[model samples]
Target: MKKRFRSTNPVVVGLATGLYPFLYNYYSNFTLVDSLGQLCFFVAFFLLVPVAINICIKIASKKIPFVAKNYILLLTLSNLVGFASLLTFSILGPKKKIILLVIVLVFLLALLLKKQLKKIIFLQYLLALIVAFQLGFYIINNLNFSTQWKQLPDTILEAKFKKKPNVYIIQPDGYANANMLKKPPYAIDNSAFENFLSENNFKIYPNFRSNYSNTVTSNSSMFAMKHHYYKNPKPSSKEAFGLRKSIAGNNATLSIFNENGYKTSLLIESPYLIVNRPKLGYDYSSIAYNNLSFLSRGFDMNVNVVAEMEKAIVANKDQTNFYFVEKILPGHIPVSKSGSEGKEIERENYIDNLEKANVWLRQMITLITENDPSALVVIVADHGGYVGFNYTGELKRKVKNATLVNSIFAATLAIRWPNNEVPEFDTDLKTNVNLFRILFSYLAQEPTYRNQLEDDGSFLIVSQDVPFGVYEVIDGNGTFVFNKVSF
Candidate 1:
């Protein structure tokens, strides 16, 4: 019996190796369609390499006949080049010397395998199959993460506001609650910031905590006005599919604002919020530019979102506007930390960013008050800094305590009402999940909507612990519980 022949195509292996880093880093943010589209674009990009190789082989055939005889070797060498170049720049992002070292190493390996191309074709196919399987697994797991709620409940929508003050939600990412900032682990003097808010007639919620720990999940619940209980069936700790859509798409809260004849504007410093290009419901969205590079870390490239804010405020002065201005200030703790010294360094870095955020806050408040004095501005954070522990491995730590857990879930929530017209429900505004509900109740002058607000329970996932690791970290009274619940 004749043995089945194996194709000597190394392009499949090259494409898979080159694409792995992008897909792995962003698969959580991407829907199945997004993943498929990216896959096709990359495939088309990688196909160019083989086409060029074949052209070179044909052109150089007469002069160097060995080129045509060793076509497989040329293809293999090109594949190796593609893999090394992409993996180094796209994922590793090492220094110049490190990149040179990687190129040199890949060149040496290719030379070593120059004569054995046919023998290792099976191995190449194996690697490609593995990547394909993993992609399929991610898509299958995240299929259930669809848009659960597209519009707000009827009670929230029917609520009517006698006053139509412009609203602004300013988010300083990862800024902790005032109480957490004043306590042990964080022990920083935030009185100046608090005093500034107070002078501006802003009421700070002392015991505010987010319903979830991460930005996407926390904001997902905030916009939906519901407790997720980590219900998306996380494909991995890193992947929370459909949460971005929950926040950036036509979310319930944004839809209601649109229905109420308010112009929704999104001012983002970085492209992080719209990285996957979710259909943002905001009538006017501003960003300097969308950097679509592979494996982008989502940092601002000198993009002045404050300028955009001022522009939006001035442009929409005549219209009732709801602005969601997000700035990644006082960002999360560095992933790389060593001993006590590393911890201290990271803490100082966080404080430095926090100071910058305070300055930005002052600028925003001054801009709004001077231009539109009757606007209602809210200063809310997505989640805490995860200061002491590695954010990714937070749930796996055995030494977890109530204070550490509380600090992780803590967030800043302060509201500046127009003419200090704070409503009675403002006192009950304890968590981000119920923040909009209380605001809607106040706006509609409907006290009954407050009764329907979800209980302010903070749920977090013990990512490393697996299948049944979802836990209630904070209860309705804003106290830490640390009790594990079924996932």
Candidate 2:
């Protein structure tokens, strides 16, 4: 019973495994407690599995008695694989369950054959290398986050409109325009949706695109009305915390609304991102940013957000003017459908989701018009699809082989005003950067002056391979010019 059984220290192993993800989330300013809770679970899962495996091994390997140190090594090795895979479950997509099952079965078999496993060496140093790699990954990502653009200050730009209307801006995530949606593969029939909108006096911009192909970039640009110009290497490292916060915290959009005496409301699917949400002046409702990791933001929660909108904005009898900005992600991957088998509907989940959102939109509009009689509704999409089909074809290509998430620059834009007088915008081939400019011009009754804020058909759209991945300037073109820059 000589004891030199050098078992892996669970504390070191846990921290080494969980540190990067923790830092990755922390850099984004997600709440520490939620992330810590998940990290603790991750550590516990890794540690408990080995203990369970070790107990089973002692039972199965009494006849095949082996060195205790070898068992420790196998457990540690199993832990490394398990915890790493678990932490990255979202990115692992469908294979995570399979991987977990495989790890469990392999470890159980290895423990049963502990006599042969005793011969396994060299893993001691290999485990050290893995820990070092994890530490390095955390350090690098931390540094990447640290060096992003400085925080944007809370701005209070003043603008006064003669008549204030309750504004509801629903930014549907990944909703592509009719051109991209009606393409051959997807062929999502948007005409019914458009006609419904048209009948209600919502004009769908047929040729509109987002200023950038990325969500944060496009939305931030749209709200700020200034495209964050991409440098040679994209200076912000794709996290673009400043850009994210400018919208989430201290952007000119919310400021203008606040200064104009509107009770602002900010709501999104998830509130944890690269910003201090409290700094964003909002009188009503919005989820605060934190470090909590969310898997799919459940269907019930999203449905409840609309219900909340109805309660807070649509059905509320308050006399104060309200400006509510919410992100309604209908076109999220695999697309969420209520009361279904979680399968794609009508061979086009995005379309189905959009239509459902349309139904909700109609309800909101009818309610608001009934309550206030004067309200503006702006329905826009952040970017296009990442699914196989999008706006990329030889006919539409100025630059060949420009498939950043299937040319996700093509975006959806539509606007609804009280009376059915079509306000003259700069152009139908407008990018999302000019969204507010159009509204300002129309609302101010001075298109000739307010049109100056528009992009002038020249703005940059950024492309990133992953979430906050290496940002590159994608190739695109405007209405007047043909260029390699993708929008």
Who wins the TM-score comparison? 1
Residue 36 displacement in candidate 1 (angstroms): 5.9
lDDT of each: 0.71, 0.52
Q: How many clashes (backbone N, Cα, C below 3 Å) per candidate?
A: 1, 11
Error of 2 at 299 (Å): 8.5
**In model 1, which regions exceed 4 Å deviation?**
1-39, 46-73, 88-101, 149-154, 232-237, 288-297, 300-302, 336-341, 390-392, 463-467
Q: Estimate each model's TM-score.
A: 0.87, 0.65
Candidate 1 per-residue lDDT over residues 167-208, each given as its tens digit: 888889999999989886788899998998999899998778
Which structure among the candidates has the greatest lDDT?
1
Model 2, stretches more than 4 Å misplaced?
1-103, 106-156, 178-189, 230-242, 269-281, 284-301, 314-316, 319-354, 386-407, 425-429, 442-487
Model 2: which ten-residue window has the lowest total lDDT?
390-399
List the RMSD of every prediction in angstroms. Answer: 3.8, 7.6
